[model samples]
Target: MSGGVDSAVAAARAAEAGHDVTGVHLALSANPQSFRTGARGCCTVEDSRDARRAADVIGIPFYVWDLADRFRQDVVEDFVAEYAAGRTPNPCLRCNEKIKFAALLDKALALGFDAVCTGHYARILTRADGSRELHRSADMAKDQSYVLGVLDERQLAHAMFPLGDTDTTKADIRAEAERRGLAVAAKPDSHDICFIADGDTQGFLAKRLGQAEGAIVDETGARVGTHTGAYGFTIGQRKGLRIGTPAPDGKPRYVLDISPVDNTVTVGPAQALDVTELTAIRPRWCGAEPAGPATYTAQTRAHGDDVPVTAELRDGELRVTFTAPVRGIAPGQAVVLYDGTRVVGSATIAGTDRTGRPVTV
Candidate 1:
């Protein structure tokens, strides 16, 4: 249940609906102290305990399964390596795809559970033909279908999200948890990345990849400044650059691109961030192939506004052309496609012109 109010409420709702529900918390860390820094939730002994307490309150059994090794290999290592290759990776999406849906779903099926349920803010709808489709949650502000869109048809068939139908805000969830006397009722939402414990991505990379200095160049290939490491910066970054020189027009500069091969960070005006097209690789279709030459809305990041775009499947890739140029379309981020309220599918953004070229690890 992740020891969160949303999952706690979801479990209670499932149990109230007469489903035989058992709460399973994936213990994804070997060291207790390293995983529990009070900055982020999940993967700690205390979180498991809180989940068990919630399960007890709901009258269901709970178990903590050790998935530390798999989590490290699948999510942690991949996150570090993606950054090393000069790409901004979304580890949360990887956790949902590899750990939650793939690993946990298999374990749940082996334990003879009818279906797995999570507090994810997304919906699963069954078609008349007995197929499954993913949809946006009723709570638009909390809709997480962007990350959960990576699930295939099989995974969707055996998944349930009780919060999909409820228009409960975060305040409502906290109130419900408090009303039920749950311990995590008033716990502040976890902000930092879960495994890092400390929210210093650059520090983590520096510790892992030693001290490698590189040049920070402008868009015209002029060396503007020097960075300790190319992995420390990301697209759209503006602060912590330590650049002493001010623009001729006295305006601020933003990160335009990062070139790992040349070991350079490119800086330019904000307009340089505009990108009209993006290509996504390893696309996952939600249900059926979308109708030919479909027009839909897409989001490149969680909580990002959905922009109008035209999507077409070409040679195993989805090429998207945005109606209006968007900014900061980074590689290794997910591009989720939506047709109104229905989630069509999602794919990893491989590269964009504004971001230079794709770096594969």
Candidate 2:
């Protein structure tokens, strides 16, 4: 249930629909006290208690599954490694792909469960041939299909989203929770990266990857400033450069690239962030893979705008050419392609083509 209102109501609805539902709260953190509490945090000790209470009110079985080691090996470690390699990763996607759907679903099936149901704002549509496809939730504002883009066809077959088809808003879900006597009806939703208790990402990275002094240079390869570590910066970042010398044109500079090999942070004008084409690997399709090159809307980041793009999967790489220049696209972030509201697939960005030159990260 994640100790949230959405999951509580989802459990209630699934059980009320005559399906035997069990609420499973993942104890992701080995030491819950190290995790944050209140609205900004999830999977904390308090969240587990809240989930149990909600299960009690809904008259269902509740269990807290300890997946801390798996989570650390998969999501947390992957996140740190990606950052250390100067790439930005989506930890939520990894958790959904490896921990929840893979580990949890496998365990549930061993215990004779049909599927793993959650409060995710996405839908699973079955074709006439019994093939399943993942689609966006009816509530586009609350849509989370981007994060779930990592799920393949096998995972979709055994996934359930009780609140996907509903057109109601998040507020309505909370109201439904109140009507059902769920204690988390008015609970605040968790935000940001849950594991980082203080919400200071730079500080967290510093703890794992000890600071290594690096030079921050401009487009001309001229040193502009210095930083504690190259891992602390990301593409398109404008603030915290601490550059003593201002640009000759008096314009602000943005992070154009992070070269971990030389441990250098390159800063340049904002236009340098514009990218027309990018190469992505590790493609995960919701249904059948694309047959050929086709036009689709590409979303580069969560809550980011979708742009018209032509994508083709060939030779184990997905090459996406955007009609318009996409800004702030990093190598490790996922590029999810969509046909209208249906997710075609997602791939991890591996490199980008800018000004007819290929830059691999």
Candidate 3:
């Protein structure tokens, strides 16, 4: 339970089904001041209290589990490291794969719990052939299976999401919460980065990686500007570059890449950001690898528009070729594939292949 209406309702539903459910609200941080600054915080003491209150109203046992140490190491530190390495990382996916499904589920099993349940908007389906598959929520706009794509078959087997069956709107969920008299029925959704209390992701990283002044270069290797650090920018960033180098063609510039090793930022025309091919590592399949090379739809970021692509799994890596050029794909961000609404697989992008054909690798 994240001290939110969804989890509370999930717990209520589970209990209504005659299961001895325990509400476990993960205490993801050791900071005491972490509380509701609206509906956007989960690390606050107030959240735990709210979870406990909901557990009482639902007539179930509730406990706050401190996973702060692991969260810092896995999600927080890894985020800074990815940025320092000039790769955009999604901490939420990391938390789901490592902290929630791996750590929390393992703990739940050890305690004799049959399965771990959450309020995530995703679904697990048992195909007619007895294979379990992860599918998108009925509401595509609010679907979150994209982030949960990191889980493999084993993890999916032990997980449960009660909100995936119907295309229930957020307002409907809130109304259900209100009918149940949940205190958090009206809680606002959490916004911004959770760990960065001040909401400055760059400053939070800079405090850890510190500052290293570097030169900003154009695609021609010509120094155009300078920044305190290269990690502050991402691929395809067009604003706050604080650079004065105007293009000869009089077109606005966009960030093409960030080289953290040499501490340089590369700015170029927007077209230079287009990538026709992507080479990614750390491939994770919901089940086993595909029988062979397959054509599917893929998204570089969770909120990106899914486009048709040819994905090939070879030598333990995933190589994707887009039918049309895609922009802003960055190393270290997940490239999630889908066969319609069902999640195909996910891989952490390592590089791009601009000249590759949209064929099997």
Ranking the candidates on lDDT from highest down gives: 2, 3, 1
- Error (Å) of candidate 3 at residue 49 is 1.8
Winning model by lDDT: 2
Q: After TM-score superposition, what is the CA distance of residue 335 in candidate 3 from its true location, in Å?
A: 0.8
**Tens-digit per-residue lDDT, 96-195, candidate 1:** 8899989999988987886889988888888898998899998998898998988888888889999887888888888887887777788777656788
* Tens digit of per-residue lDDT, candidate 3, span 274-311: 88988888989998888778899998887889899998
Find the candidate with the highest TM-score and give its number.
2
Better of 2 and 3 by TM-score: 2
**Whole-model Cα lDDT per candidate?**
0.83, 0.92, 0.85
lDDT of 2 by residue, 1-361 (tens): 8999988989999999999999999999889999997767777889999999999999999999999999999999999999999898899989999999999999999999999999999988899999998888999999999999999999999999989889989999999999999989999999889889999999999999999899999989999999999999988899989999999999999998998888999999888888999999999999898999999999999888989999998898999999988888888999999998899999999899876656677
Off by over 4 Å in 1: 354-361
Please give the clash total of every predicted structure, in order. 0, 0, 2
- Where in model 2 is the C-alpha error above 4 Å? none
Q: Give the lowest summed-lDDT range of ten residues in model 3.
A: 352-361
Q: List the residue pairs that clash in candidate 3.
A: 34-44, 40-190
Cα error, residue 361 of model 3, in Å, equals: 21
Give the TM-score ranking, best first.
2, 1, 3
